[model samples]
Target: MNKSARFRQSIDFIEEHLYEDIPLEQAAQAGYTSLMQLYRDFYTYTGHSVKEYIRKRRLSGALGLIKTSQLPLAEIAYSCGYSSQQALCKYVKSATRMTPLAYQKSETCYFFPRFDSETIRQVTVTSETIPRTIQLKFYYPKQRGIEHQAVAALRTLLPEYEGRIFGRDGEPREGLFCYELAVEYDPEVLNRLAGSLGQELTEVPEFCSTFAKTAVRSDESEIGLAWDYLYLKWLRTSMFVQDDGRYFEEYLCKGGEVKKLLLYLPVRKRMDYDKISVICCADSKFLVSSREGEQAEEEASAAVLKVLSRHHPELIRTAREWYVARNGMIYTCGVRLEQAIELPADSGAEVLLAAAGRYAVLESSSCSDREAFTALLDAWIQENGWSKEDLPAFTTYETGGQAEPDAITMRVWIRLKDVKNG
Candidate 1:
């Protein structure tokens, strides 16, 4: 199996046996790798060591049971691999700064949908205008490997995040649901120091905001519940109201069984979509296959595979695929340029510059048929009263970006008119 698949296997093993004692050897064996190798790669991929990840997961799991069930604390502790109730309480306090009794009381007194209200440490309210932020746009769907691009962006733009992620969920751009993962930097300083990078800029107006962090895993419904609480409960009770502006979620680390997500929702005293500044795309390097015509699809596939085999055979790790339309034709196979290097001439692979500008994006899985995909995009564009722009459309593969042509998933991007000034 490929590295991504192997890593998934290892994570699956850990999640399955989370309530039990898991040794490093077992996890390594699950991945078909060595202890040291798994240890190193695990940290690189998940931003947490095996031991640390397991501990946090166990605590979170135990806390969930404690809040929902009538089971005694001792039983919950033992079931969650804790030695005793006392041990569970100690661990909980250390992690969340709350005792079991206190946590339970808070849960009883108040709640935030799927999450316990007490677990919410604090919701800091701020009413400052958000400065211009730089973000890399990419697609995130209910699939694998797409997140790698986001991680790559974080590493390139914000090294401080390490492998951790901080992102703003964006509405569908083009025909895909695109996310703008912000680069942590002062926009003014970046513009002053390197104004060229400002092409990736987006600005937000002043608004009232509530911020909270939770040990909730990304896969859980509680994450959505937290958002719902901010909107349904917190915002409903406060004087502030949600505007058309986008809310943000900062992921401290990539999702596994343990993730600390800082959720933020900036509410406005009044709606101000017009007051908000429009954000444009940043310049990007794209490695695209150029084949167009009656046989373009077949020819493009062969060309992309040829390029990969010659220059980047290592990228053939997964079956992810991507495509985009341009000049009345399609580029059958695609990947962001930074993911690959050392392109050989006449191999059907060329580096193209993608200009910074507005675009509509939409996410589609490999499983969807062409008609369904197109229909979805059509509905979204029409409903939102959006129009296509004069720029070329594109897509990026979610998998290794090279594989058998049929096994790929992709995100499509269509250019949009510069509506910010309009």
Candidate 2:
């Protein structure tokens, strides 16, 4: 019944089934609370949440086994609840910036058990070398709407890759997974997988003409690395550098087991602005700084979100978390401050709602992108002539004086006005 007792019960559950499949719901049941509540309280009592604690505990034992045995990575990974060895490498890299074998190679492998009794035993440590994490150069088109038709178009033009894709690997990834579709001529592949399609139907709906995309996978570490290879090392050296523009991954839902997704630099194909709004967030701090070879700021955004969720779960329970690869972290942004006006009036009773109502907001990215885009949105608003609704709450930051760090904030507000009337 008490918080302390519930925690002890949950910890006991973890201890008894250390090797068992520990889902969050199951762990929460031990404390007789909902999964979200369990997560909040557990993380409240322990710096680590339930899943994190379990992962560390498992990784601890995994290190022990690695040092004590010569088992392969798959075995080590499966034994520790990782879906694949690649997934294991992903998690390790996210936390420690190394792979199982690389960590072993650097001789930084140590198994420190949380329970005191296990530390008494002396064990011999062994090490090994590991292959580097491979970078995948995935190509896609810019238009989400034109994706499927473009894929069908590519098949029509390139007769070799026509019906089936690459060595008959079945369908090239379908719509749900396809980020963008591209076409480019590959001299190497011209002799390889080139052919004609059903020929262009001029009378048919206009499909933006495309070059056959030369999407290839190779081992590299970062996107910048891919650019260096493609531009500096390979581009000028190769005879014809012309290719169709590519729409690489601009957004990610959950990057899953990826470190850096390889991308072809976006170049203009038809000499025009693609009618697409780059949906960016309030701050480009992490994403922009990454280009300067800087790590993302000590990310408290999510931590702050956690605190917000703890206090205002309802507003953020349905919150979206976007995986921005360049930044190398999940951005669990609360709703746009301007969206607050859409909420039911009763929502204001909650801490977040009240906070949202009072916050002075700014859409940092909306400001950063071509000013015309925001102007476009404002133009639409002006054209509609609907100005009575107040601007919504937005999460914004401020600086009172130069004496202290700038406030990393959560509440911001927006004001909607009729330009013609005002």
lDDT (C-alpha, whole model) for all candidates: 0.56, 0.38
Question: Compared with the true structure, what per-residue lDDT tens digits does model 2 show for residues 152-187?
Answer: 444444444422121101123543323223233334
Cα lDDT, model 1, residue 392? 55
What TM-score, computed on C-alpha atoms, does each candidate reach?
0.29, 0.26
Off by over 4 Å in 2: 110-422
Scored against the true structure, residue 166 in model 2 reaches a CA lDDT of 14
Which structure among the candidates has the greatest lDDT?
A: 1
After superposition, the stretches of candidate 1 with alpha carbons farther than 4 Å from their true spots are: 1-281, 318-321, 326-332, 400-409
**Candidate 2 overall lDDT versus native:** 0.38
- 55-149: candidate 1 lDDT, tens digit per residue: 76687567666655789999999999998889999987765566887876542211111111221223444444443444556665532333445
**Steric collisions counted per model:** 11, 24
